[model samples]
Target chain A: MAGIIMEIVQKGWPISRIKKFIYLGFLLVAAIFTVLYIVKTNPINYVSDKLPFTLGNEKPRFLFSIYGSGMNGGLSKPMDVTFVNDRIYITDTGNKRVQIFDRSGNSVGLFGKAGNKAGEFKFPYGITGDSEGLIYVSDMRNANISVFDRAGSFVKILADNKQLNKPGGLYISENRLYVSDIAESKVKVFDLNGKKLLEIGKAGRGKEELNSPNSVSVEGNRVYISDSGNDRVQVFDTEGKYINTLGFENNSKTSMFVNPRGIGVSGGRVFVASKVTSYVFALDQNGQKIFTLGGMGQEDENLALPNGMFIDEEGRIYIVDSANQRLVVYQN
Target chain B: MKLTRLSLILTLSLALVMAISTAAFAAQAIDSGPVKGDGRSDYAATPKNTTTTYPGGIYLEYDANGVAKDIHSNYQRNTDACASCHATHTAVGASLLQWANVTDTCNACHDGTITTTYDVVYGDFANGTRTYGGLFGGTTEGPNSLSKHNVGEVNIAAAPGGNSAGKADGFGSEWGKSFECSSCHTPHGQGRNFRILHPDVNGLATINRVKGETLTSPDNLVFSSLKAPWLYGRPYNSSNFSDSTHTAVYVNGVKQLTGFSIDYKTGKVTFTSPPTGTVTAWYVPSFKVTGDVANKLTANEKVTYKEGFNEFCGACHTDYAALTRGDGKRLTGVYQEAYRHAFGFNYSSGPNKKGLVFSNNAAKSMTNEFTCMTCHVAHGADQTWWTDWKTKSGWEGIVSGENAGSSALKRLPNMATCESCHEKGKGDYTY
Candidate 1:
């Protein structure tokens, strides 16, 4: 290449012409760089690569993936999911109802819809059951949390008005119900009855401030709130005493919760579902991470927007694979 | 000077000898395909190398077509325990560490890889100075500048520039600005299908913005690669102006002296000015272009100056002529006067008479370049900008002027520099 270039130069090209050629060369290089950069940004709809499902370094196994018909044809935006007695209850958010299925993926029953009346749900996003088989759903748009019996009977509504603006996630611990409110940016505590207890943290990015507080899960006397806007998790005691903060970084990967709408703390672990990364990170007792699971795919195991997660006493992991429109169960 | 026939013969002979010896030593031939579990040869860099063995090493074996033949890393294999080493850490620094000092732990094995005899060439190896290798290759620095891992100088504890404030506090010499063996090249072996450090280091495979390109998207836009947010001729004022640090200021035409970083909570911009010049309005740069004038960017746009609707400093530095003529040469004030940082210019809203501001002052604690890497780490198979062979740990070389930020910026160590520019809302805290 150098010899060929030397021969061309030996032909005695004019300096002006040579300078023009250099400018042309630069223009060509710039054109190439621009084209490369433009081609890099392919718009949405062109689905990116479906990264392999990896929990830490483990290939998410198929403990069992049951495929059976459902009552609503197929799940649509299954917002939040919970597991109890081999039964999986999912908050079909877009369907405006709750669908119950067994471990075998067989539909057991369905309840709730877009209504302000009792027993009905409007934008249901959170699901959790109590020891007495009492189901609690975060009726987000209604700004109230409704309770129903295992038989799908309306039990009660424990919140109303600005107090529970867009209640997204619910967890029952020590007879106290913790409700994660998105708009209000605080977790409204209440008793089994419709009586409000104490409100914790206003909306802001501080140790105590909650920004877009989406989900809550209580372990012992501690409640963990996903401070979505702050890109961190705020931990507080049952009495509203701020304990500590977790996942404090602006990076996309190291983030524990970015728009995290649902949380489940069980077996001394906290599972945070990040709406941005679409991964469920498991944290230990001290909020130390055990592992991060899930990826972006529509397949049964892959998560799209995992809004809610539930861990059974048996250590089985269940996720409401929201955008994928289905329920995913990860059994040990 | 032209080479004589004899000289050419001698050069050719030397080149041939060097190429032959380099090729022979480079190819530490191994069994075809990726290494196997516990297979010590598995740790040896293979041709189409895949599968590395480490505690919780996420392994993925891909065929020539790039389809995943197998994925035993991340979560499949029991060894996929990232939390084992990179535990749930939430300090103000880099989390995810089993032991403290990352370099000390990595050196236990890499120090043995380097072989030196009578004299040390790279650095003071005996005094604990050493170098590392590139991604995939066994040797430290390869012959070609491109082929080499480009790991920069490693500053050990004895070294002056040790990262004392790093995640590993006083544990040992921290991996400084320079790249190390484990920087991009995870010592535990690359389990990522795309070869990132963590699961989403670079980005997920499915996160494509265009066809064929796996790891490219708008979210991947690094601040360093793009033009700076040019806030051209916008109203700006601050409440915290004092006559101390900010000794000189000019609003529209009046001459004043005041400098203060805004604190939104108190609605004040704290600047120390001399006890003279009165506080006046200033023009802050726009954070994002809302109109065609602010956003109309084109190709080969000169970095220095341009005519209409461009981000050249010359646009506002009309005073550039006046200043240069008054003095004999260049002045740095060209940036401070024409360019601004804290004032609001984003589409959200600009600072008003209330003395509000939007700057990264809220996060004054952070360091490091706040460009793309501030929020994005390259080589993360799941969360980085793109995949390049050069992305092995710490091998990130100097940026080409074309690829640099508005000021031909080099990367900083922390996220503070970013806040110096991208802070949101008046004052430090947005609360």
Candidate 2:
């Protein structure tokens, strides 16, 4: 190689000309290398158009999402949601208030603030409402349940800390309110007058036991409890007897129920929010999964660490996308 | 013909250079694939919707592929847990936290509903065990009790050990101007440091974990390659190595403490004689605990304090921490007082008193070191027992009022922590 370069230099080529030719070759290689680096590391190459699930094709199609900061008619780490009188109520946990929104995902108003007063909440984890335009909120940090009028007035307090410790997920049905005592891992049933009716489940992993029960939903003679720590939902008769379990056997990588936080029952189907996976599962009464919705993402269809879920009579599912600070509404 | 030959050689060289450069850049740019247990392949490409119109701009750490990094314990690589505290597009707080403040974000799950295992508000785990760090709120001591860290206190104050001049390690400037949970603890896992403490706290000092070493010795004489000069012991989930101790040797899952001796400086474990069966020396490595390893740790897993805690805290409390002997008494311009508690020494070197609570029960021998956590709880103390003493002696009025008893954040009430070890005049209480 050296002899060939020397021969080229001697054949009608001066030393300076030969040097210029080599320098030009080096410059050409440098320019090519720079172009390749730019193309390889371009941000556009990393952008993916693929999504986890196709939108509008799923069983429960996502409609839209309502989001904002607490001051701007939005939510802050909203934990639970309830619908009554054509209005959506969200427990805006971060702001220590409950935000009210219209059925079309428009902000109506908000109530409660950060205080221990009758109209205030330290941390509201779960919420529910009755047909009489009355709203019930589980004040998690205060360890009590507070009731409010439809217009968002503080009416009274129900179920003191003595009966409940770290209360979560409120469900009202048939003139009775079911509260999940998260600290005690028991679901306490109370009448409309705040009288203790029946206490269900103990703190254990056994058949009738619950560990960190988050939500409770009652449909006719049946009740569903989201046994969160156990990663399963336990169903029981209205009389507080164990009926069956759901989503426990589906403990696979793709479909397992991990830290199931929110639950709703409607149209002979059970809707559950798996908190860690950020997926909402619609299961039949027989515990077979029909379809799963909402993997973790910031999109309208995606849910990030969803909590309380409410399936209205019309089968419209309202999920409190907690981490996303939004309420995602889905309908069949 | 000669010019054509030269051009050919140059072209070949350019092709080789391009191939090498492309390979190097691709290695750095390629995504390592989906994290284990993450089902979705599109997770890496999830775009962070940060807009100038949004208040408190998003502050999430993302990889080159725009995948949000996991920044919590329990599930190290579980990106799904990221949504539990962060809001990718609609973040209300700095750092993309779902809540407006750090305290509220932490309390979302630590408030007992999600998991009672870490109910910081109540200061107790699910098993009713008091956490080393005391409560942020909800103390049963009294209605007017001030027994908490005041995690989100509006009026921030300078830390006790803070120094305007700088930190002891000569790194930080103006230590303890502001304080939050992340000031001391890194939400993202910190190598193998206990409790995910930050590697550098407020620029006071850098806390580096000791690199671990593993050795298989046919003869139980010498095992080397341990990196760190100081062998810090950490509790393992396995029953055989449940105890937290330095340089442990195992034979068939049984710890061989009696037969082995370790040289701390040289990082060598010397056994008395050759033992039968497979012999292995295991030390905790300084690496991030992945999801696989974190899943194995039980909810009530013990956290044994290793070295570097004094420097971690001293980064903020500049004068309070004593990293060496007699340093607590060595007063400086910050605080001219020789009378302060000495720490960062092994318990056996001092009194070696009985009845003193060791951080870990299994390793309650001379190896247990006396540090800040020895007498003080990290967050705050709920010592109601001091009430009786304060009332009877009229000390409540002399001090800062009714809440004065709870100010120090001590583990025991009314100097009981000091009495437990010193036994001053209480001989009967000595075990």
What part of the reference interface contacts, as a 0 to 1 fraction, does candidate 2 reproduce? 0.17
Encode model 1's per-residue lDDT on A8-87: one tens digit a residue: 44444455765676699899978877775665422211121122321222222335433324435677556678775457
- Candidate 1 lDDT for residue A153: 76
Highest-scoring model, TM-score: 2
Q: What is model 1's DockQ versus the real complex?
A: 0.01
Fraction of native contacts (fnat) of each candidate: 0.00, 0.17
Assign candidate 1 its CAPRI class. Answer: incorrect
What is the overall TM-score of model 2 with all chains considered together? 0.58
lDDT of 1 by residue, B177-241 (tens): 33433443443333321122322111111121111111122222222212121111112233355
lDDT of 2 by residue, A198-228 (tens): 9999988778999889999987678999998
Best by lDDT: 2
The 0-to-1 C-alpha lDDT of every candidate, in the order given, reads 0.45, 0.63
Q: Model 1, which residues run further than 4 Å from truth?
A: A1-69, A84-86, A249-256, B1-431
